[model samples]
Target: MAKYLVEASYLSKGINGLMKEGGTRRREAVDELFASLGGRVEAFYFVLGDRDVIVIGELPDNTSAAALALKVNASGVTTCKTTVLLTPQEIDNAVMKSGTYRPPGFDEPYEVENWEGEGGHLAED
Candidate 1:
């Protein structure tokens, strides 16, 4: 299973519905949704400011995560963004792989790793 971070903000219609049903109902609805997907909701909170809800959960894969986002967005009452979470060990594994790449307009010349060159002659505009 993979972890995901969900940030959702309720629109006016959703807010009105929330006010009528209260927050506990909203949490229950989320729990039910995850349960139906064979997943689990780890943490859920109704917060202030730009986002109304923050959810942490795990699903089988990225497809499941995307499905969750699409379903929430189709509701028309709320907007959601789903982020794929990575652990520290995953990042370490990623850093071990070698790849070729260039930055910006450095098609002329550039070096990403260790280099021996004149101090002021390194970068160009």
Candidate 2:
């Protein structure tokens, strides 16, 4: 499963709704949303800032996360921003992967021309 950082900002109407239902109920509703999507809500917070809520959760994949965000956004109550979070191990693994990508109209791999390499000059230009 992939983790996500969900930043949600409630509109005026949503804030009024929250005032009526209360924070605990709002959090419970979020939990139910996550449960219905085959995921779990790790943390849900209502804070004072540009964003009203911050949620950390894990879903099966990016598609699942997007689906949840879109559904909530369509409701017109809150605007959500979903960010995919990567683990340290995932970053380490990615750093070790093969790199064969090249810029357009280029032949060899791209690298700093004047930057010194570990052992010394590593540029071919």
Model 2 clash number: 0
Q: In model 2, which runs have C-alpha deviations exceeding 4 angstroms?
A: 103-107, 111-125
The lowest-lDDT stretch of 10 consecutive residues in candidate 1 is 112-121
Residue by residue across 73-121, what tens digits does model 1's lDDT show? 9999999999989999999999687776565656754554434455634
Residue lDDT tens for model 2, 9-65: 999999999999999999999999988888999999998988999999989988899
Global lDDT of each model?
0.86, 0.89
